[model samples]
Each structure stands twice: as C-alpha cells, then as structure tokens.
Target: MQDYRNESEQFDRIVSIGMFEHVGHKNYREYMNVANRCLKDDGLFLLHTIGKT
Candidate 1:
C-alpha cells in the first residue's frame, strides 16, 4: 500500500463526511491511524456517516 502521510501537511482539523461506511470495520482502525498521522497534536477529527434503521 502507498504511504499517503507524506503527501500532505499535517492538519489542524480533519473532516470525513459520508466516507467511513466505505472504509468498513476491518480497516476502520487503519483509517483512524492514518487520520491521526495526518493530524497535528490537539487536532480535531470529525466523522459523519449514515446509520441503518
């Protein structure tokens, strides 16, 4: 897998809208780890995904 971390500058805030569902459970931790790596200390990460009834 490619390392996307070095491709961008650290962010103070990261937002994911309607994207987590595509990540699935198996890779959620990895997703978060990448998000964490992309974020700066004291940064904020927000995730908005649809819920099943």
Candidate 2:
C-alpha cells in the first residue's frame, strides 16, 4: 500500500473528469492514489464532476 502511494507521484499531469462518479465511497482513497501518482510536482491537475440527477 505504501509502495503504491509512493509511486503515484511520478506523473507529470493528471485528470479526473467524470471519474469521481464511478469511484465508490469505499474506494475513494484508492482512486485518489491514481491522481496523486500521476501528477508531477509542478504538473497541472483538473477535475470535472457532474451531479447525478
């Protein structure tokens, strides 16, 4: 688990558009790991979330 967390910070950029909806409450942390690893120290990250109606 720690290894995955450490590896997540190797990306230059990350996007989470429309992904939050698919991420269950139980797996939110794991989902975040994806972005965390993907984003670089100075990389740009964008997130777009749509409400479910």
Q: Each model's RMSD to truth, in Å?
A: 3.3, 4.7
lDDT of 1 by residue, 1-53 (tens): 55543436789999989878987889889888889888999999998999797
Task: List candidate 2 stretches off by more than 4 Å.
Answer: 1-10
What C-alpha lDDT do the candidate models reach, one value each?
0.82, 0.69
Alpha carbon lDDT at 20, candidate 1? 86
* Predicted candidate 2 versus true structure: per-residue lDDT over 1-53, tens digit per residue: 36334463466667667768776678778867677667777888787887766
Clashes of each: 0, 3
Minimal lDDT window, size 10, model 2: 1-10
Model 1 whole-model lDDT (C-alpha atoms): 0.82
CA lDDT of 9 in candidate 2? 42
**Top-TM-score candidate index:** 1
The all-Cα superposition gives candidate 2 an RMSD in Å to the true structure of: 4.7
